[model samples]
Target: MADKQLMTYEVGEQMNLMALLKNVTVRVAKNGKQYLDLTFEDQSGEISGKFWDASAADIDRFQAGRVVRLAGKRETYQGSPQVRIAGLRLANADEPHQPGDFVVHAPMKASDMEEQINQVVFEITNQVWNRIVRFLLAKHRKAFFSYPAAKHNHHAFEGGLAFHTLSILRLAHSVVQQYSSIDAPLLYAGAILHDLGKVIELSGPVSTQYTVEGNLLGHISIVDGEIVSACNELKFDLNSENVVLLRHMILAHHGLMEYGSPVRPRLLEAEVLHQLDELDASIMMMTTAVEKTSPGEFGERLFAMDGRSFYRPNEPQAGGPAVK
Candidate 1:
């Protein structure tokens, strides 16, 4: 098969544009006029292109998430590449799409991330916390297996949200170990359940778009409310203090009220969990954003996460002589 990894191509660059390759999403956009939105990918990266004047017959040939080939012109639009479609058709059923063609299989493997999460779950000794973890892990297995962390933000890949949450909890647990006064078990539990409500907040698989409840109730409210209800049903001896502490972790996971946190972290465990969550999320976003761009290249503006474009190269030394 021709290399589809080079999804990004400049105008006048001669390359075979095959749509039949795997992990491609095809959408139609009538921007001023009719255009085919070709979302193609390979192991290296994925790119979106516009195919102007795409015929209706071609449009009928494929549905969303189907692989197709494009034979047309490639041009740059505001620094990003777009394809002008001359021809497009679906691939044979026997033809397999490359796993790397989709964002799910882009940089990180979901299995490894899930394995780490499983390891963390096994480490929990508290029976109540263990049961809650098991219930969530099992109930959202399918979605967690295929969902992205966000529609377009950090860790937005299959199993990403769970993977991200697990990492945060792990780090938070490690950080709190230094403080002897804090309850490590409760803190660990809080970290684990902090973002469970995300299962309801964001849709999974094809898109990680926010649901109506996510937009209104938000993850904190949904998670805290669910935890309370579940604890009530199971008749767990959830002390009011512990309940409040855990709820605070969820409610303040976002770290700031303006960012949707119901309140700032007050307790030591909640505060630690909040900081760890923020640290993990922000680092992931920055790392992923920087990695996607070429060395010395400035990343394209990230709207869903970081608002500004980031330069990829390390800054030059202040006193070093300039390169010849």
Candidate 2:
């Protein structure tokens, strides 16, 4: 008998259906088609599945971000392995762990990402900006260190918000410094502080979910309001235009009303931050999704990322077919 490759099942492995699924989100498909679509992960990474006739009774048992067992044969679509459900149900606490179990992260490593943020902070020479940055970084360390950038968008892994935000700001600063026409401190500060409110907007990894505060007051307002309060405390010697400009960058980072920004990027620095932030985040999402996908196959459809499908690159040639 061919040993099943754990996550990659062979023809007739006695796999437990409920043990292999992760982030199992069940919902009604179009035209009343009972369906379930969710990612199944192993140590190798995550892959998604869609079941056409997932039952209503079983639907209640499986929820988003929950693991379940499956007893089914492995099937492929477009060269991707998908589980055709012979049986499925909720995985109990005491159920023996399976080899190909999927574990979802709480965004993506916020603490290490925060250290990257501090690199940008140390570069600022403006004392007032430094104080404001310190206060928020200190006060909201928990949220700042843990929250996902969005509920389902890019950087949705553990500590993903912090990692993405820091990366965007750092990259943006590098580019802006070349011109020297832009104020380095202001632009970098704006970039670093741009997504500070995300801590409150989303929950941490332990919970791996959103909170009431997030639903009501979003990251934009939370961050904008915090910046205003921090400025008041620091007694910043800023003209109204400077304050407004910085605030606009935070408010407009989302870049569109439909997307979430109340105001668009108005100033040069604000425009730069918005564009760079978007560019970094989008690239990260696409690249990470691609990495999780199998080689010689197109990746799963990313709904939050405009339903864009990505193709995994073919593996490099194995040095001319193994010289004997």
Error of 2 at 232 (Å): 4.2
lDDT, model 1, position 173? 62
Candidate 2, residue 41: Cα displacement in angstroms equals: 4.6
lDDT (tens digit, per residue) of candidate 2 on 1-324: 522333655534555544445456667877887787865654444445676677777577666555566566665565445666676666677764542234444444556677778887887777777778888888888767666676655766556667777777768767876877777777888887888887877665432456687789888888999988888887874566667767777898878888789988777777788788879877877887676566666876777678778888676666753222
Instruction: State the lDDT at 309 in candidate 1.
Output: 71
Best candidate (score: TM-score): 2
CA lDDT, every model vs. true structure: 0.64, 0.69
Estimate the TM-score for candidate 2: 0.77
Report the Cα RMSD per candidate: 4.8, 4.7
**Top model number, lDDT:** 2
Off by over 4 Å in 2: 1-26, 29-37, 40-44, 50-60, 73-81, 92-111, 206-208, 232-242, 292-297, 301-307, 320-324
How displaced is residue 150 in candidate 1, in Å? 0.9
Write one digit per residue (lDDT tens) for candidate 1, span 87-137.
666665666444334445424466766677777777667667766666666
Model 1 alpha-carbon miss at residue 183, Å: 3.8
